[model samples]
Target: MQLTPTLLAEATRRGLLSTEQGQALWDFLAEQEREQQHDTPSFKAAHILYYLGGLIAIGAMTLFMTIGWEQFGGTGLLLISLVYGTAALLLTEYLFERKHLALPAGLTAVLAVVMVPLAVYGAQHAIGLWSDGDARHTAYRDFHYYIDWRWLVMEFATLAAGAVALWRYRLPFLVLPVAVTLWYMSMDLTPLLLGGDNLGFFSDLGKLISLWFGVAMTLLAFWVDLRSRHTKDFAFWLYIFGVLTFWGALSSMDSGSEWGKLAYCAINLLMIAIGAALSRRVFAVFGGLGIAGYLGHLSYTVFKDSLMFPLALTAIGLAVVAIGIYWQRHEAAIGRSLRRILPAPMRELVEQRRG
Candidate 1:
């Protein structure tokens, strides 16, 4: 099926075409392949630089923002963010609509999305909606480091702006800000929902809320995945952050009894199975860590005095490795069988990815 130069030469040898024609066809196909690679996302030098530069810019604006910028005050930060966002959006329009560059356009759109929170923070402060007296609410930089109920306004604004940008640009990378904001909202909403002057931010109730929010986000990702599979991997970021939120909150909760810990292990095992079934590695990675942590706990406690523990652990590790080898060898058949066992709609979901 692959039209390679070797195959073309063989055809010419068999008198199917002249040497000139074979060379012409090969050159044409090579050019076509190159064009396709250029059009799509890849690990090429240009593409790598595009993303790397964009990430650094984004980090500088958000995560790496300095305390000195706090001197700008709310209104100043607001105006600066709007100006930067406008420039980024104008550039995005030029790149996508004029220059026809998708990667850089997406990156610029993401930059615009990142400005939403800063603008919102400024508006809140300038209008006296957010009090400057609160330390957590004093500066925009704390937005990345602290979780306060007051951040809800900025978080909601970011989500809205992110949604609008994604809808306008139709870029997969635009999902990043939305997913991250949702994750922050999950934590920030805790104190607000539980009710207090920020009393239950790290309470047991907050943890449960996080777990539930993660479940919702994961389900949303699944829905997005099923819909976007034919177009782009728009659901990828959502699945990543969703799993992170869920797994982190789940792992943080105390399981006082051995039975409780065993139940936790079982839940993680289910996550791994679900991940494998869906071909999404995010679930598998977190699940694997959880299982490893449980096993480590047992080794340190239940098997501490047993000399055979090390041998048992080694055997288990080797068995897992063997299973992986066997799975890789029979991947096609196994994948087909797994898909077959699912309900019709679920099978369709997996089949779309596999196909």
Candidate 2:
């Protein structure tokens, strides 16, 4: 469905548009796409450096915090965070206004939002609201690795700050922090929801929550993609975290029965199908890994002594590859046939893209 130079030239020849008009339209759109490519963070060297340097600075401020950093009184830490956040915000303003760099501006703004959790932590510590018993002695890195209900305050504050930054900037890069905060919240909220009463129960419940939150995030990503067709990818972060949480939670489940394992495999395959439909490779990746894990388990446990199992699996893989080639060759015809087989309303749904 994409309009390319060839399509435009063909259209001009077919009298859909005058030659001049066709060329003009193509040129305009080509320029726009080029500009967007330059501005948006991607695999380009400049963009990579922008994000790498920004992440390094951000990591220094948060993730790489030393025990010595905690020696600074809570008030001092809070003041320092405030100073850093203010500087980041000022840079964001300068970039947006003078430099016209949306991606860099959003990254700068995320730096500010990134400081929120630390600032909130300091403020909480300054008051008598330090984290749970053992968490009080835990390093800042533990905030990421471990879930404590006390961390909810920091997560909420970070999410709010990220929301404000995104609202003010309208930049896609800002979604990273928000998506991350949501992921953290998804884990942290588990303890509170379950009242942190039983360790084993909490672990299982947290995984369930992670799976559902991922599902919700994935659905939301689809909604965003549908609404923002032909624009920069605003749903990329959502898709990433969604797939991570969903696949992580699903993979962690200890399926006892063969039926349970088969169901798990089926869900992963469904994820692959969904990925193909949506053109989101994250879904395919997670699904592929999940299926691989399942297959490995079967190989090591159920079929350890069965040489035929590996042969059968190899044959299945070859069949899939052959099917893929056939699909590639006649995708349009196959799609038409599938749609024709559907009810009228369903056919319309299949034929239509987001718009």
Candidate 3:
């Protein structure tokens, strides 16, 4: 299916295409390839470096922040965060407009979005929003490691700033920070929704809320996936975080009965079917993990003493492998058939490229 220069030359020699027509076709195809390379993420060394550098910079300001940063105090921290955010924005504009570097520009924009929470935290600290003895008052690092209702203000600010950055840049990478902040919000909102800090995150109410939130986030990602038409995928990060949130919460919940566990396996199988229909590997990955966990449970508990257990498992494994090979061989036909079962409007959505 790949068109090459040799193929074009052969066509020209065979009189299938005139020399001028072949040259024009080659030029158009080459330009399209160039654009695709520029806009899409790949494992190319330069692209890897771009993401690596950006992630390190973002982690430095957020995940890897130190307690030493607290020495600056409220007003000083606020000023420093403002300065850093402004500089990142200026760099984003320069890279995007003057240098024509989309990847680097998007990274800088993400950096700016990441700074919003820090800035919000600083502003809150300056205004004495944190009481003197509170743990959250002492370090910004708790934003990631701990769950508290107090972090809601910063999370909301980050979401708003991320929206602005996405609007300004129209870059797919801008969705990364936004998706992450939404995940954080899902956790933090639990304490507030349950009406007290007395119940920690592991409480039953918190888990149920997280499960519901994950469903909402996944539906949002689906809507975005259907609408996106850009060269780069904008819903990829959203789908990843959404599925992780949902699956993690669902898996962590206690399923006491045999029937309940069987239902879990069935749900995971449905997830696999959905993944095939949507062409999203994220669903397939989590669904496969869920199914594997169920199998492991059966191995250790239900069939542990049975003599035929090992043989049965081996047969199932081989069957799965054979099915995978068959699936790969007829993947295009299977995908087409799956698409046909969807509604007309949703069929179009299914045809869109997935991350």
Candidate 4:
């Protein structure tokens, strides 16, 4: 009757067993496990039914999206998907105790994807992607002249809805959509400060503000993770890295001198290195992106006038890979250390099994 330290911690977290109830729960669970070694016919039948129901539900949703929903208006489709997804999630939570089913997350992610494309199409339509008469007679021309505040209101409403959903579900997948909405909002406000005539300044300011906000959010997420110890949500760290890299790219683009370029490259490399040293997965993934970017810069330089092999790229790649491997090994050691720190009840369970 062995209880792993991880299992004990999980039990404590779930309030399944208090300090006094730990030993009794362990004994009961062990006995239950022993008695359940031989599965009953009904148990097997129930499992089969559960899986079959999940499959059928997924298939039906897929068919509805492809056949019935695609023909609807963009707004209508989004609303339908939202309602159906919410209903499905509620039903699953009520029927089964599975709180974190993938279907709802999948549905929301798909809806976000659909929103982006539809929003882009709507923008194109308003901007006169296809206008037969005078260019001034196009939808784009009319849209700007008669710019409705309702469009801005709708965007803000959508952003608020997304924020609420993310907060309710605690899903990290919602971060991108939330960030996108924030960026759009920032862009909408840029004209107020930078002036509509200074398009370049407005664009630059918008990007800078968005990147700064992203960095701020990333730092906040890390702070939350530190308090909670939920390293599984690695996406927040990745988002931070992405925003920093983008900021670096923008800085490099604006740099005019050779030394300025070199400084930008050095700063970007330093940030990536620091980030990689902190997280092995991020290091492994973003190290590749950093290498590709450096190589592209090197290629551009070579084509312009300078002909030189990029030894720095090779060295940087090797360094990143080496650090990633070290972190992986270090993480394993940490796991072993944690196992040795098991509480008394869990340690007792382990001893019982050994006896």
TM-scores for all candidates? 0.87, 0.87, 0.92, 0.49
- Residue pairs with backbone overlap in model 4: none
lDDT of 1 by residue, 1-355 (tens): 6677788889999999999989988889888778667656789999999989999999999999988987787799899999999999999999999998888899999999899898988888788776757555567788898878888888889889998998898988899999999999888887777776465436788888888889999999999988876777899899999898888888999988999999999999999988977889999999999999999899999888999999988998899899999999999899888778887767877877655
Query: Poorest 10 consecutive residues of model 2 by lDDT?
Result: 346-355
Please provide, for model 4 over 211-262, each residue's C-alpha lDDT reduced to its tens digit, 9 standing for 90 to 100.
Answer: 5654665565545444334323424533555555355435535557767656
What local lDDT does model 1 show for residue 157? 90
Is candidate 3 or 4 superior in TM-score? 3
**Candidate number achieving the greatest TM-score relative to the actual structure:** 3
lDDT score, candidate 4, position 303: 44
| Candidate 2, 1-355: lDDT as tens digits | 7998899999999999999999899989999889878786679988998999889988888778776877776787799899999999999999999999887888899899999988988888777576345534455556876776768878888988888887788888888988988888888788788876343223877788888999999888877776555556788899999889888888887888989999999999999988776667898998898899889989998899998998999999999999999999999888777667766543443345423
Candidate 1: pairs in clash: none
Write model 3 residue lDDT over 1-355, tens digit each, in one string. 6899999999999999999999999999999999789867889998999999999999999999998898888788889889999999999999999998999899999998998888888888898886557754457888988888889889999999999988888898999999999999988888788888765557888778778878898899888877784345788889899999888889988998988889999989988988877888999999999999998899899988889988988998899899999999998888778778888667876776533
Candidate 1 Cα outliers beyond 4 Å, as residue runs: 1-36, 39-42, 199-201
lDDT of 3 at 207: 76
Cα lDDT of candidate 2 equals: 0.82
Name every residue pair that clashes in candidate 3.
none
Task: Please report, as a residue range, the 10-residue window in candidate 4 with the lowest summed lDDT.
Answer: 140-149
Once all C-alphas are superposed, what RMSD does model 4 give against the true structure?
Answer: 11.2
